[model samples]
Target: MIVPVILSGGSGSRLWPVSREHYPKQFLNLHKDDASLLQEAARRLDSLDNVAAPTVVCNETHRFMVAEQLHQVGVEHARIILEPCGRNTAPALALAALAACQASASARLLVMPADHVIKDEAAFARAVMQGQALVERGRLVTFGITPYTAHTGYGYIKRGEALGEDGFNVDAFVEKPDAERARAYLENGDYLWNSGIFLLDAKGYLEALAEYAPDILEACDSAYKAREEDADFVRVDDERFARCRSESIDYAVMEHTRSAAVVPVDPGWSDIGAWDALYELKAADDTTSGNALHGDVMLHATRNSLIHSESRLVAAVGVEDLVIVETDDAVLVADRRCAQGTKHIVNELKASGRRECQSHQQVYRPWGHYRTMVLTDSFQVKEIVVKPGAQLSLQMHHHRAEHWVVVEGTAEVTQGEGHGNTGDMKSFLLSEDQSTYIPLGTVHRLKNPGVIPLRLIEVQTGTYLGEDDIVRYSDDYGRG
Candidate 1:
């Protein structure tokens, strides 16, 4: 059996504004569809023979988003593994191999990153079949994309002696080459772009890892053995998982292993690492210009430019080779040639302590979302939406008082000292034009009793209206 391990733990900083630290590009519908990149990745393996439900390894912070996205795609029971901290691809794969080995002793693991895009599913499946055959013969396999150009953004893999019809022994792994060397590599038809997809048997991988990356293997072994299974997630022990030395699979094992092999894949695969790459994938006019995600854009006489606006209409006049991104709090305009340096801007924001670099004005929660509409010294206003049957934590704020005016649907409001009691909990069914007030230190909880989304405008008056002022007494979603 082949157990597909999907790694979805990247903070896509290059595509900022649209992709923030809390919410990255993998979760967004970059192709302007309901399905995200991660969802598409999970769906791609559905037709493969002997494929088990995907085992997802993601960061702990993105656990809710991962769960919600998978649930949206009708995946009810996938093995969702949570990484306490990222130790790069090697340890992540080691943990996944350990899990698959525990479930089935002879399982073959097909590891793929969740953020990639493969346009041709049939070609990808055929490549996977070749990879599976190689893995069954005890070969550590990696997919190498047939390079289309002298692109310096990605590393290249050199092919060695041919092992089969569609497989070759990996000659060497080369780092990102300079422009001249990249051009030379493209000219010589023996190199392929390192696509970072791999296939190997569970026990074979563990043995190869023990030989090449013993420290990583040992750390992962201890972490997996010490893991505690929650309701639906497998939580690796924090101390052991953190002790794993951070490294990629290329550096730790694939490069050093004698059994390494490569399979050529030319299925329109793209990592989508930068704005320029996204522009290349998008539909373009004669001017080679496109709009970024979630923007009202109008371009005239523009060529090779990407304009994105979130809050207002953005018009570009006579601009060429530019990237313009606008969010609620910040806007960025840069040359398309230097789009890779956008990470420097994120680093500067981190050094100077700016919230705009981290998240947006609207924050997503498992229940719903709350957007900060207005803020002031003595008061703050927010628009909150609660999904049907969803409830906020039973909590109280020490330094703030709140007034809620329901605009749509019905809200079940509980107030006063007897917050959780059966008889003392007075349920006030609030509808349109109805409102309620809760004084400071009063234990209150809000719930959407109706089948529709509950929308409300919240006005707060307090000495301190920060989010940390709340003391959660009880929560339904296991949040402390």
Candidate 2:
């Protein structure tokens, strides 16, 4: 049986502001549909036959989001493995393969990144089916995208001999070439864009790793052996996994393996590495001058650009070849030609310790989300939304006091007398327009009991208003 391994470790810094470190592009609705890229990737498995539950490898900080998105898509019993720190594709796949082998000895992994886009599900299904026999026979299979253009952005794969009917033996794995070389490869008709999607026998790949990169294999084996299960999360040993060298699967295994094979297909794939990539999604149909937009956006004579407005109306006039992205707290304006250079901007922001690079103004938690409304040294105000039947941790702040004003639905406030410890819990119901206050160092818990969502305005006054000021004594989402 085939088990999809969804690698979702990328920060997607080129798509920053819209895609932050805390909430990356994989979870965002880049396709302008209700489902995110990760959800779509999971849902795409519905097209494949005899596929078992997928294994998702992601950052530890993004565990809740990954679980929530998969749950939204009804992908239950899926393994969500948490990487304490990114050791790149090689280690990520090793953990996933080990888990798959433990579950079923005859498992084959269909490894794909969570952030990839495929327009034709049928084409993808056909491509995967084409490599089934090859993978079953212990051949490491990779899906090579049919190159339609001389694009210098991606690496190329050269095919050698025909492997059965669906694939060819991988002649060589080449790096991203310059414009002249990319054109040469594109015109050669024997090359394909090296799409990172792969298919391999779980045990077979592990054996190949043990031979090729034994240090990565042993480090991952030690970590996976010491891995612990916590609810939906599989926690790998951090220190051991950290010692594993960071490298891509291409550099670590595929390039060195003699059994590497490629299946060429076109499913309208794009990694969505930058804003221009999103714009190009529709430019082919509109004579290379279409404006791809999301949210509330208006354009007058804007050509070959992308305008994404998250919270407000963004109106652009007479703009050509530009990328305009607007969110609640930040806006990005860039030339479409140089949109990939946003990585440099993100690096600068990280060096300067900017919150915009890490998270959005609206932050997601296990319960729901909170948007920072107003913040200062002495006081901070936030708009908090709790999902129905969800609640905050029963905890207290050491340096801050909070006042919650209910704006929608209902809240059950559990107030404690003193610090964050066992005490007489005084409970009260707060309806719309009702207000409550909890004194400094007082333990408090907020729960949504209504059928609808609970929305409230939280005003806090304190010496330290940072998120770390609160100590979580008890949390339903298992923070404790």
Candidate 3:
């Protein structure tokens, strides 16, 4: 059996505004309307045979989103490993390998990132099959993309002696190069872009890790041994996993392993590292004006540019080789050539302690999502939606009182005092146009007890209206 391990722990700061700390690029439907990049990655395996359910490794905070998205795509039996802190791909892959070997001793693991775009699924499958064939011989296979341009965005892989028709011994792994070096590598025709996708025998990978990076192997082993299962999530020991030094697969294992092999392929792949990649991707599909526009956008003489508007109309008069993205809360404008520099802007926002750097006006929870409609020093207003059969935690605020007005469906409201005692609670149903008030320090829970979604307007008044003001006495989702 082949186990697909999807690594999805990137912050994707370069694609901010749309991609935040809480909702990253993997969970976004950038190329497709209904399927996200992660979904596309998971669905890609549907073409291959003998593949088991995927094991997803993501940040702990993103566990709900990952599960929800996978469920949306009819993937229910996935094992989601939650990392308290990212220790990079080496440790992430180690966890997956350990889990895979535990399930089936002969299982091979196909590891891929969640946020990559591969247009040619057939070619990708062919490459993966080639790697799988090589894996049978105990080869640590890395898929190398056949480079067509002098792309400085990706590292280069030098091919050594040919293993077969489509496989080669990995001669060297080169870091991201200058434009000159990149061009040389492209012209030389002996180099391929390091695609970061790998196929390995589960037990063989663990042995390689033990030989090449024993400390990482040991740390991950201890963490995996101490793992606990919560619903669909497998959570490792936080402290032990955090002790594993952060390192990429290239640095910790592949670079040191003599069994490294490469399978060069051209699968129309993109990491979608920055806004420019999106432009390039869309521009490929439409070549009339070299402009890739999304949402409510009107462009005039905007050649070779990308303009995306999420909530409102964006008009560009005269822009060339530019990228403009407008969301509900923020807008990004940059030269397409310098789109990679957007990470520095994210760093600046972080240094300034800006909330926009972490999240948007809308926040997602296990129950549903809430969008801040208005915010101020003394009060705030939000529009919240609860999925059918979903409920919020039995929670209370230390410094704030809340007023909720039901706008759609029905709401089951529970309000109480004194140590969150349900026996002392007053529970009632509020239909459309009805309202309820929750005073400060009152234990309250909201549930959508109808067949449809429940929509409500929430007004909060307080001296401190920060999200941390809430104390969750009991939670349906295992939140602290």
Candidate 4:
């Protein structure tokens, strides 16, 4: 059986504003109307035969998002492994291989990054079939995209010798080349863009890692051995895994392995590395003016540009070759030619300690989500939504007092003084237009007891209204 291992650890800084550190591009519905990029990755495997439910490797902060998205896409029995920190592709693959090998040592892994776009599912499945044959022969297999352009943004792989009708032994892995060299590579007809997709034997990968990157293999092994299952997630030991050095599979194993092999295929693939790449993917569907407009956007004399508006109308006049992205809290305007420089702006925002670089106004949680509507020195207001049967933690805030006004559905509220006893605790129902107040240091909990989502407005009066002010007694989501 083939175990699909989906790696989703990218921050997607280049797709900033819409794709923040907390909610990255993989979780956004960039291409498909119904599925996000990660969902597309999971669903694409449905075309293949004998593939198991995917083992998703993601950051600890994105565990809930990963699980929820996969569930929405009807992918059941998936193993969602949470990495305490980012250790790049090598360690991520190690964790996946270790977990997969638990069930069968000879399991073949179809490694795919969660954030990629592959438009041709038939071609992808065919390539995987070819890769499966090569992998079964104890060869480490990586897919190489048939280069259509002299694009310097991606690494290149030179084919050494033909292994079979559809495979080649990798001669060398070339770094991103300069313009002149990239043009030469496009003309050479023997190079392929390194696609970062791979098919590998689980035991064979572990053996290769042990030979070339024993430190990484050992660290991942220790962490996997000490892993604990929390709900639908596998939590590896943070300290042990953090000690694993950051490296890509190319550098740590495939670069040095004698069994390295490459399968050349074209599946209309793109990493969506920057806005210009997104424009390129979307440009064909637009008018002859080469404008890709999304949401409420109007353009006059705008040529070869991509404009996206999330909350309000965005209008552009006489602009050419530009990218304009408008979110609730931020807007990014850049020349299309310099779109890759967007990451530098994210870095500057991080260096300046800006929260805009981290999340949007609406933040997601396992229960539901909340959006800050208003804020001031002494007071703040938020719109909170709770999913049916979902509840928040039984907690209290030392620095804030809250008032909740129900807007829709029904709420089962538990509020009291001290530690919520039968006498002190009051269990009550709050319907539409109903309100309640929880004084400072009052341990309280809110739940959606109805069949529909519960929506409410929360008013906070406090000296400090940060999220870290809460002291939780218990949480259903296993959050501390």
Which candidate comes out best when scored by lDDT? 4
Q: Tens-digit lDDT track for model 1 on 417-439?
A: 53333235556889998999988
> Please, what is the whole-model Cα lDDT of each candidate in the order they appear?
0.87, 0.91, 0.92, 0.94
**265-353 per-residue lDDT for model 2 (tens digits):** 99989989888888888566566458787889877787888888999999999998888999998899999989989999999999999
Candidate 1 at residue 252, lDDT? Answer: 95
Clashing pairs in 1: none
The sequence of per-residue lDDT tens digits that candidate 3 reaches over residues 1-480 is 999999999999999878899888898999888899999999999888889999999999999999999999999799999999999999999999999989999989999999999999999989988998788878999999999889999999999999977599999999999999999999999999999999999999899889989999999999999999988899999999999999999999899999999999999999998898888788876688898888999888779998889999999998798989999999999999999998998999999999888988889999999999999999999999999999999888889999999999999999996644555888899999999988888889999989999999999999999999878888989887
Predict model 4's lDDT versus the native.
Answer: 0.94
Q: By descending lDDT, how would the candidates be arranged?
A: 4, 3, 2, 1
Candidate with better TM-score, 1 vs 3: 3
Candidate 1: segments with Cα more than 4 A from true spot = 283-294, 418-425
Could you give candidate 4's per-residue lDDT for residues 276-395 as a string of tens digits? Answer: 889999999877799987899988888999998999999999999999999999999999989989999999999999999999999999999999999898999999999999999988
Deviation (Å) of 422 in candidate 3? 5.1
Number of clashes recorded per candidate: 0, 0, 0, 0
Residue clash pairs of candidate 3:
none
Better of 2 and 3 by lDDT: 3
TM-score of each: 0.95, 0.97, 0.98, 0.98
Let me know the TM-score candidate 2 reaches against the reference structure: 0.97
Among residues 3 or more apart in sequence or in different chains, the pairs in candidate 2 whose N, CA or C atoms overlap within 3 Å are none
